[model samples]
Target chain A: MIALSINWHAEDQAWLLVAQNRRGLPFGIGGSQLVAGGALLALSAPMAGRVASWAAVNPHDPTPLLRPPAWDDAVVAAAILGAALLLALLSRWTERLGLRTMLEMRSEEGREPLVGPVSVTLGPDRATIRGATWEASYDAALLTGIEEPPGYLILRFGAARPVMLPRRDLTEPDAAAVRDWAAGVLGHDDAAP
Target chain B: MNEVSSGTPPRRPWERPVTPPSARPAGLWTSPAPDRGPVLVVRVDTEDEVAASRLAVAAMTPRGGLGSAALGGLVMLTAVTAVLASGSGWKSPVPEGLPLLAILAAIAAFAGLGWLAGAYLLPLVRRWASVAHARRVLRPGPDGVPPDGGGPARVVLGTRALHWTGPRAARRFDVALLRGLVEDRDHMMLRFGLVSVVVLPRRDLAPEQQEAVRDWVRRHAREGRA
Candidate 1:
C-alpha cells in the first residue's frame, strides 16, 4: 500500500467563522419580514382613502367602484409574516442539526491537534491520525471531499473540522503521492502528474 | 553473532526527504524599518479600493437557502402591499385624501426598510459612497504626498503587524491575532477579529509574496501555540 505520514493541523478558525455567520442568517431574514409586514399593516387605511377620492373625481368614467378591505389586507400581511417566521425557524433548526453533527464528530478528541504536531498517515484506502493522547483511523470512502485552497490541502468529513496539511512542509513527491492516492479513492481526475 | 534476524525493513515512500524545492523567485518592494523588521510596502489606488469595496459587499451579503428566501419574501410582500393599498378602494373610517397619504407613507417605509436590511438600495449606495470616499481620502497632493501629513495611502506588511495608513485613517493590527483569511478570485480578506477585516487586491502581490504571506500566517500560528 502506498502510505505517507505528515504533520497536520485543524482549520478551527475557518470553521468557527462559518458557523458564526450561519447562526445570524435566520435572524436577519425574520427581522426584515417583520418590519415589512408592520409597515404594510399601518398603511392599509390611508391607501383606501386615496382610491376613494380618485373614484369620486372621475364620476363620469365607466370604471366599477373598487373597495379595499382592511381586514383582508391585515390577514394577507399576517399570513406572509407568519410564513416568513416559519421559514426562519426551519432554517434555524437545520443549522442546529448540522452543528450537532459537527460537534458529535469533534467529540473524538484524538482527531483534534495537540500542542505538538499531529501525525497523519495517509494510505491508499484508509488513513490513520494520532495526537498526543489518542489515535484514530478513517476509511477512505467515508471522507466527504478534499480541497486545495492556496497553501493547504484540506480533507473534509461532513460538517466536522477539516484536516489541513500545509503544502510547504511536504516534499513534491510525497505531495504527489498523497494527491494520487486521494484522487483514486475519491474518483477524481485531478491527480498530480 | 550467528542469530537469524529479519533484514532491515524496506524504506517507506513517505520516509523520503521532507524539504521541497524552493518556489520561483520573484522581485518584491521591501525596505528596512526601525523596530518593525522588513516591511513590504504596497501602493494603493482607486482600482484597489474598488476591489476592496466589492469584497466588503460580498462578505456582508447573506448566503444559503433561508436567508435568500427571506429576502425574496420581503420584496414580494412589499410589492403586494403597495398594490393592494394604492389600486384597491377601501371604505375608510377617516377621510378620502388620507389614502393617498398612506400610499406615500408605505413607499417611504419600504424604501427605508430595504436600505436598512441591505436587501436592495444599501449595497449600491455603499459601493458608491466607498468609491467616493476612497477617491477623496487616497488622493495624493501635487508632490504625490498625502495632504493629511501622513504618507500616501499604502498597506505595509511587517514582521509583527499589518499597517494601513491613508490621509484620514491609520490602523495597525498584529499578525498573530489574525483569526482567518478568506479569499476570492480577485481579492483576499484578512480578518483580524469578528468585525475588523482588511481587504487586499490579489493582483497587487506577486505569486511569491502571496506564498510568503501564507507562510507567515502558518509560522505565527505554530509559534503562538508553542
Candidate 2:
C-alpha cells in the first residue's frame, strides 16, 4: 500500500481530504520538494527551448514563454524553477484566502479521486471543512444534506455526487446518529452501506 | 386510448428465461426503444428495506463527490511554504537553496489540483465500467436474448422483493461488486435482499428513461412491506 499523508478536517462547513507524496516528517518533506523540482525541471527544460524557438519566430509579440534570457542551462532552469515556486506559493496562498468567502469554487466543482478509509468529523453548522475541498456552511442544516456517496460525501449544494463518509465504519448506532441527521435533510434513508 | 402494435420480447443475462411467469403485471406499457413496444421479461431482485433506503439515498448522490478540501488544501500548502520562507528567512535568505523550497511548492500545488481533477474523472470512468460490467455479467442481452431483446411492456413489482444485490462479486454479495472504486467508494456492492413492485404501462413514464428502468425493477422485485 502506498503511504500517503492524508488529513481530514472541516473547512467552510464542509469536509476536506488532503494527501501528499511526502515520506516521513521534518527533512523528508524537503526531499519531497526536490522530487517535485525534478519533475518541474524535466517539464520546463523542453518548454524553455520551445519558448526560445517561439521567440525566433514571433519576434514582435510578448514572447515571454520562449526560453530564458540566459545562455547557461542552470540559469534558465533557475528562472523556471523560481517561477514555478512563486506560482505554487501564490496558488496555495490564494487558495487558503479563498476559504473565507469561497467567491469562486469553479476549481473545486467536482469529485476527489481517493479510494480508502476516508476520515470524517462534525463541525459547527457554519464551520468550514478542511480537506481537498474547502467548503463552509452556516448551520446544522448542512449535516442534513449529507448522503452516502461512492467514496466520500461532500454535501455542498443540491444533489451533489456521493462521497464515502468514515461514519460507515462506525458501529450501527453510532453511524445512525449521523446518518439519521443527514437523512432528515436529503429526505432519504441510508442506514446501511 | 391509442394502441400502436405494442409488445416486447423477454431478455435476461442467463440463457434461461430469467423473467418469472408470475411476475407479469396487468396494465399498459412502453419500450426502451421508442415504437418497439414488444413484450419482454426481466428478473428483478428484492433488497432489504433498511438497506434499500440506505442504498437509494446513497445512489441519489451521483458518485465520487468532493467537499471543501480543494480550497483548504490549497491554503494549507501555501501557509506551510510561506511560514517557512518568510518566517524562517528561507524566502530570500539564500537564493541557491531556495530552489528546493520552490520545487516543493510546485509539487504541493500540482498534487492538490490533481486530487480535485481525479474526483470528477474517477466517477465518470467508474460509472461507465459498472454499466459495461453489468452488461457482461448479465449476458442475456447478448447470448440467449436476441439482439432485439424484449423489454418490460409493463412491470409491477411486489413489496416482498425489494432487495438490492449488495455488490456481488459474480458468485455472491460483496462490496467489490458495486459501481466500484470511484463509483463504489472502494466497497463492492450489489442491491436487493427484499423488495416489491407493481409494473404498469411504461409509455406513461413521464420523465427519464432511468425512471423506466426503475419501473421495470420495481415490477420485477421488491421488499416485503412492513
True-structure lDDT of candidate 2: 0.32
- Model 1 residue runs over 4 Å out of place are A1-193, B1-41, B57-68, B71-125, B141-172, B182-186, B193-201, B215-226
RMSD, one per candidate, in order: 21.9, 20.0
Error of 1 at A67 (Å): 13
Locate the minimum summed-lDDT window of 10 residues in model 1 chain B.
B24-33
**Which pairs clash inside model 1?**
A46-B99, A50-B99, A67-B89, A68-B89, A68-B90
TM-score of 1: 0.30
What DockQ values do the models have? 0.02, 0.02
Chain B of candidate 1 achieves a TM-score of: 0.41
Residue A184, candidate 2: alpha-carbon lDDT = 55
